[model samples]
Target chain A: MVAKRTVSEVGEFGLIGRFTEGRVQPVSTLLGPGDDAAVVAAPDGRVAASTDVLVAGVHFRLDWSTPEQVGRKAAAVNLADVAAMGAVPTALLVGLGCPPDLPADVAEQVAAGLWAEASRVGAGVVGGDVVSAPALVVSVTVLGDLRGRAPVTRAGASAGEVLALAGRTGWAAAGLALLAAGRETPPGPVAAQRVPEPPYRAGPAAAEAGATAMIDISDGLLADLGHIAEASGVGLDVRSSALPVPPELAEAAAELGADAVSWLLTGGEDHALAATFPADAALPDGWRVIGRATPGAAVTVDGEPYAGPAGWTHFT
Target chain B: MVAKRTVSEVGEFGLIGRFTEGRVQPVSTLLGPGDDAAVVAAPDGRVAASTDVLVAGVHFRLDWSTPEQVGRKAAAVNLADVAAMGAVPTALLVGLGCPPDLPADVAEQVAAGLWAEASRVGAGVVGGDVVSAPALVVSVTVLGDLRGRAPVTRAGASAGEVLALAGRTGWAAAGLALLAAGRETPPGPVAAQRVPEPPYRAGPAAAEAGATAMIDISDGLLADLGHIAEASGVGLDVRSSALPVPPELAEAAAELGADAVSWLLTGGEDHALAATFPADAALPDGWRVIGRATPGAAVTVDGEPYAGPAGWTHFT
Candidate 1:
């Protein structure tokens, strides 16, 4: 049997060539990898940009996820940020740091995952840098074209607005709970945890449908909505009964002796799009009306403050 | 004295607020930090992008350089990449990872350094992310505006073109050597090592002057020139006598029994701009003739292959 080669053995340039060689780029990528910088088309005269960092153990454990899964998560988080701004993703620049002893295949798989996720949204991996570090660190920066629309910021929601959500929520959190309890019987939630299916088209659709405010639900429904409430100086309330609870999530929660509704309200990482539209505005397809914006500055559930965990936060 | 607050004590949001709050952005920044993503003006209808990652031990040692200097270095390296593409830098998105125990002030200083350097080029720090990790990692992505000019890539040089250089070389290498020898007498070189001064204007200037090929001298003169040579299918030969050996570098080398010319030929991190132009093209101010492109594919010094170490490379 052949021994697996480490990243150190392949060297930085060699590893970079392996990851980028012969990969096809989308039309938006005017100049791809092999240059000092890449040129990406932003025909709307403006560009939306975002960055996200993922660290090994802190963000993902190799034992719990494939290197590819980690890469997909990294790209998904940043791509979702771009979509939340009502923009179409155009290009991605990746910065990868790896331990010397890490297998070269792991790094290649991570790159493949990033490319796969980016391709799904018609974006290209245009440029990147590879270096040595104590642990695996993947940083992704995404660029998007706004196509002549104003950005839907967290500060734009107002009183008398209808709150809506696009895509699934709580499934990732339930999957995490299942994993913690050493049960993987329900592959649905576990798969959601591994790779999120963010409603990418719903973002631009919401913008076209006159969304007043928007944010990707990265830190759970209640916690992320709290951002909109505080930024827009309005009160937000979510109807617990309105949130769709998938049968798989409910089954997993029942088996784990947990509350599915709580997960639906407070669980995160599904990369769902949560947005606010005018009371009279028509919500986009797949978007369900969940609640409304009021005249104060607090986020509530069923007209009362939620009594469970708020969501994910870094550091403490 | 009051105890310094650690990053974990401040929490991720608090740390981010302290670093980004009240900072002024340039006109190109349509939306600054605190949003899911930033909107930056790209009036040229295209954006040039680049990403670079710096690790704590491999890229910078806190003990040898101030946190602010380290941050400046991080920003400079990436900004230089954008400049090398003959584009005007418009914005920066930083992804920072830190140990929980790292001082909050240290992190703020790092952000300040990044802002200072970015501000020098009239660019804005538009967005970023802060996450917890085992060590300090700074990943920066910069966006640039091409202003209707074609990107000056490494693949355009041809035989019979004159090679020219803008900005100093060997200074940073001398500084690193001085520090390694436990002697920092020459403040110039030591400072250069801490924060590189990339000639930001020279890139576009060279492009305007009709440069056939260009590259930022990050991995040293010969090594980087080799990139252009290979990509453009030409050979590059540098005359040793034409390379500048700054007086401070020469004095430091003399004291340390080192070769100043070798540093001039092989030192990196100065981010000097090197380009090949039509033989009769008028050189821009601050750029001096150093070599010429010739037939074949080898990078030579005074018509012979260099026998010393080439330049820096990550991993092995």
Candidate 2:
């Protein structure tokens, strides 16, 4: 823990000076932070955008997650949405809220995490705002480039299409469980909770390969699949026998006496990409076919209705 | 007040459906909400961005402001920043944090307010996140287009330049003072506080006229100009004798026994446009010559130090 630095210690202007100093904007950003607004080149003539807000205690526990981890997650989640649209991320805008008593370093670490993750997806942060609040809150909005490719949406999936996933799953959920259990140390699942490793390039790859529909699994796999089904007006059937589970997740589930299948089926926050394609489509690297789109508006596991929790639902 | 319908009643997906239905995208936005991210056109090959956050108690009091008012104010402040950049606003992404107990109609009204104001600016509310929080927090990120014009910044103001303002000044401050005083009925200043009318087109006008630099007066006129002076490393002197004082502001200042000059000179949130131009530059419409730029780095009034409060500081 660090001693808190009063916000007035570095005046609002002074804090802005610290946050913005020496940062280089991508060539696409014609104007950045110092101005009223930042100007970025949208060369493809179209831009993609999404926004998310992560609140303290609700989105992450300060006691369990470092500010840096929170920052990375904040930026990464929005970046995943950009990628989900099959777009090249170009610029980001962040709005941060914190108590005036919060340490300056915490703010800096958050910015660092945001920058690091944004850079991973080849994007730049162009502008931001810092305001006083009762609790720490980080809100991020990402703008992206479609690069002349048509956007892949959740409503485009069709009957007889193959459902594939191009990233890991259940790790964040496992990590959340570990944290809930009061584990003093970071285990594989707990570590997964800190920072998700989304497969960034797979989204564009799926789009290039003519994906019929696409979505990112921020909710549990089943819940996300249901979103595709509802949007595409079809049914989805997951083959539980073919489910992929991380070895660490399996071990952790065994120790906790929890069903690994439950986590694999319903855990979320791994930001894995899921898309439906024609039967003849070629799968991209890292993609695993876990299910198939069917004619009826229902979901099943191994062709049967496996009894378990449906998935994540907002407001419990 | 109407009966409050719990947000949980509509559910997150239901609320999204209510907000996004019937929304029209400009030719610029190829994809709108319901997709992972929206696609909008930036034909000029550049995009301008800015973000701001408003807390329930800090930025606006729910008791004094309707949810719709809060939404309009939230959008206005950010859009003003984009206008300050001499860019035409294109899209906005909103992130809202509210308690589960709040009314869904309140949220919808907020969104409607957001849409109304964005519509006024000829922009779309492209995408957003809705999450539960302890209090209401609105985060808005604005994306704008340069329209092939170069961006105007605060740094280009130099010595031997005339400083002028285009639009109302001190009204919002007087408005705030009136609101704080709690008159039985709404006063002119209070109305100004509720909704500020920014000089939206003046930025491009200044840029087109070869103005050296420009900024919007979100803070007091002196303080914001101080930014331009500090950024340009020059001095600015405001001529109080030539300043424009709206009668509404004058009456409120007189009623409150406060110095009207101080309010007009150092007050903020008027969203007025301030800029410096060459000695012989032609000022734009609704503009008044109020000062000049000099060789040193400081802000003054009528060639002397204005003996009063400096300006608005957020935390204090």
Candidate 3:
């Protein structure tokens, strides 16, 4: 194998060129990279926007995952926010900070990973900035179009509304448990921890199906649901039996002598969409009714307060 | 003075609440913070977008400048990119990563500075994320509306077009010189380096005036202009005598026994707008013609190749 070139050897502009060369932009991109700013078509009267930052060691360890995984995880988290807003993601702006001594190929893998994941949502990388720092920091800001639909915010849930969820939960947390326990777990949970593929389409579907409120589970389910409950001035009563716990998570939890229910309730970063709808509303496919919203501000599991972790807090 | 609370004490969620609580939003904000994502009005069909990252120590030193200055500078730099596209800025999404040990007030000041600078252009802070990191990293992504006008891009310049600038030059570079030389300098240049105030409205004005090509002077005059020349496939012949050299820059150069012309040519972070226009077009009030787009690929000063520094490079 040939030796790889380093970022310091090619410089910032050179690395940028490598990332942008021959890139095919999506139809929403009015003006792509190479300019001071990219022009993206926000056909709707309003544009939904969100941002997230991932730092090395704190967010992800470079040794455990590839740069590609890191890139995909960053893009997925940001896109998940747009989805949670009941919007279709259109574009992304990535701001990458890496040490100069890093291999150019590593940065390329990161950019490639960004493209690969963006293509999953049919969005494109519209603009970015590259800077030198002591460690790798990936910051992604996503833009989405609401398509004339009102945003499904956390404040819209009403008492007596049915609480529902789409996609897997607690899998990522179980994967984290495995990684922490230093045990060889199944590939499914481990991959879930490394690269989260949020149910992007479920957001728009829930909106079309008349979702009253929605939020992406970046923090644990209990922690995130608590946010919705507080914002909507309602209590979320989650049914412990309704959660779809995958076999891999259960197996991993059993091996680690941990409770899978705790992971299901408090797992964060799964990028699952939790939403509320009218009691009699017809639910869309992949959405499972979990419980109901009640008056007051609390999130309880199985008619009782959850006693496990409150959720992942950036600073504890 | 009372002892200030640290970020770790307040925790990430608490600090976020403090920064967002009771905040005033601009007219363009349809949905502000506290949701899955913020929605901003995009009256025009297209939105110009850009992202930039500023790492502590690499981009700014906390000992030399206040957190407010860093926040303002971050907002200004990102807004300048939107301005460079000849679009009206609409909203900003900030992603902040800092150590948990940082003072809570310092983070608040950073957010406040972002708000202060964003208000200058009538834009609102739509959304953001805060994460824990080893050091402070502020990443800002700005969105802009073209208002039915075509985006001014770097690839539109033509040979024989007049090259003009709408803001001051070399001030930030001069300020950096004073800081590096450990000399006591006036507040003007030092402030310029700390918080750049680019002519934001001038971007739309230049666009209305039919600017053919445009770029922000973040990477020094010669270096950034070189980008326009290379992208437009034209030579830029800058008249050295016509280049704007502020008085403070000259004084600082004299005190340091450095050539002021070098600073004027190669200074970065000034965030000045440079564009190419029809030679016969009536220039706007703040814009001054300092050069002409020529028929070759080289950027010349006074018809000769510049021999000074080629501006900043993130990596060696």
Candidate 4:
């Protein structure tokens, strides 16, 4: 029988070597892990960067989500933020804190998840720091390349522009609803919640087509669009009828007696792209027109304000 | 009297707005916060990146150090990593996790501390995320520009090269000993453990002066030098008599009946820079030679293998 090695037993440096060994790094990485710092190609003279923190109990539960799922979701969310800026992800630096008693394989699974998601977009996990802590905390910082194009910010939307969205919106929220209700959910939506697949290609495509402003819908449709509205000094009127509610979400909502539309408007962590474009400008394929930018600052659905909760908040 | 507000009361977005409202961003930032991602100028078509995670009760204690000290130390350590690569820090991304019960001022103090240290290096805190957790965790990712110079990695030391160091050694460990012994120490050494002042300038100076290899001394002199020796496939013979032991550490060692040389050899968190230069190369200012690289794998002191505790281990 094999003896199970804990993180504390292998030590910090040993664990890092274990995870980094035999891993193939993306070509964009000039230098990979094992150095004090890693060198990655920026290519465009500027690098786009963002960070996110995930706590064990606050952001995820070990019992509900596998270590692999947590790692993949963490990478996906940060990559989504980079994509929202109309940039291609080049590298990621992960900072992880785990309790000493954790099985070494669990940490490896987390690293595997990070590598899997990063490989999907041709990005590399170039460097990271691991330390012992009271609970598990994963912090990811993503670096992206703009490719000499202008970054699509949240403050560029104008009145009379058309608001649009790319990728699924309500799937993750529906999965959350199922988890909260203690009901078993289908594998598709459950995986969607655990590991989001954001439409990364749509971001650069929309930027190429001249998107006025853009944001990743991590904090729900209405709440995230509210950020663009607040930044650009414009209002958004989303048409609820135009929202593409997945059939699974609709069926789940009916079974749970919950409103699927609420999930569409206020469910968070879908990592979908929401943006605005000129009324006459042609939008890239996969982007569905959901609303229009208006002169006022209020975010409304079908011209009336959203009566339910706005979106996810870190603190209650 | 004003009621003390917790992080949850003001909400995550509200707390972020409060901290970032009037903060001045560094000039290297092409785009600052309040967006999906921030853009920092990389200049030489490449970026040097590293990350560090600090957890409460592990890396620091709130009762012993102020939030400002914690923040500054986090930034300083990561900046030291960049400097070890012979690069100048340009930007930082912070990810913070705190319990909802944490006072809002505590979080602000942490951010203030980060901004203060970053400004010293002419870098900006371009982006960050805040989330509620069971403990306070500060994860920092620093980006630096090499300005078209070749990165000084750990694999270049030659057998005939001279091993040298810059900045204070064993000061932080001395301070930790004082703290652990429940004795009062002078503010200088005490502050060293809380907030390190790494010799950032010496890195590029050594690089320009044609140093063979470099590493930040976060994990003690012998241990970090061991990394360089292993990577460069050379042995190091350090001269214990030549080590620069600060006067305060000597005094403290006398009081505790401990050997200051132990701290110098095995103490961690000083964040000094250790490097190797050609035997005949003129030493740069602020650097002192204390050893030489040899042809074998063992690290020794004065031709003898003097082994006390080698260095710190995360999970002993």
Two-chain DockQ for model 4: 0.90
lDDT of 1 by residue, A63-96 (tens): 7789999989989989999899999898999999
**Candidate 4: where is the Cα deviation over 4 Å?**
A1-3, B1-3
Tens-digit lDDT string for candidate 2 (B1-316): 8676788777788788878888876656667888788877788777888998989888888777788888888888888887887777888889988888888988887888888888887888888999887788999998887777777788998899999888878887887787788752336668667778887777777777777888989888988998899889999998887886767767787777877888888888778989898999888776778889998788988778778887887665
Q: Write the per-residue lDDT of candidate 4 for residues A1-316, one digit (tens) a residue.
A: 9978988988898889888988999889999998889999999899999999988988888887999999999999999998999999999999999899988888888988999899999999999999998888999999999999999999999999999999878788888878878766765667777888899888988898899999999989999999999999999999988986778887898889998889889988889999999999898988999999999999999999989999898897
Q: Per-residue lDDT of A1-316 in model 3, one digit per residue for the tens? A: 9777888888998999989888888999988988899999999778999999988898887777799999999999999999999999999999999888889989988898898899999999999999987788999999999999999999899999999999878888888778877765787888888888799999999999999999999888899999899999999999977986678877997899988888888889899999999999999988999999998578998778988787899888
Local distance difference test, candidate 4: 0.91
| Ranked candidates, highest DockQ first | 1, 4, 3, 2
**Candidate 4 local Cα displacement, residue A214, angstroms:** 0.3
Per-residue lDDT of B36-113 in model 4, one digit per residue for the tens? 999999999999999999999999989888999999999999999999999999999999998898989899899999
Q: Which model scores highest in DockQ?
A: 1
Full candidate order by lDDT, most accurate first: 1, 4, 3, 2
TM value for model 4: 0.98
Q: Report i-RMS for every model.
A: 0.6, 1.5, 0.9, 0.7
Interface DockQ per candidate: 0.91, 0.72, 0.86, 0.90
Instruction: Tell me the alpha-carbon RMSD of every candidate.
Output: 1.1, 2.1, 1.2, 1.2
Better of 2 and 4 by lDDT: 4
TM-score of decoy 3: 0.98
DockQ of the two-chain complex in candidate 2: 0.72
Collision pairs in model 1:
none
Instruction: List candidate 1 stretches off by more than 4 Å.
Output: none
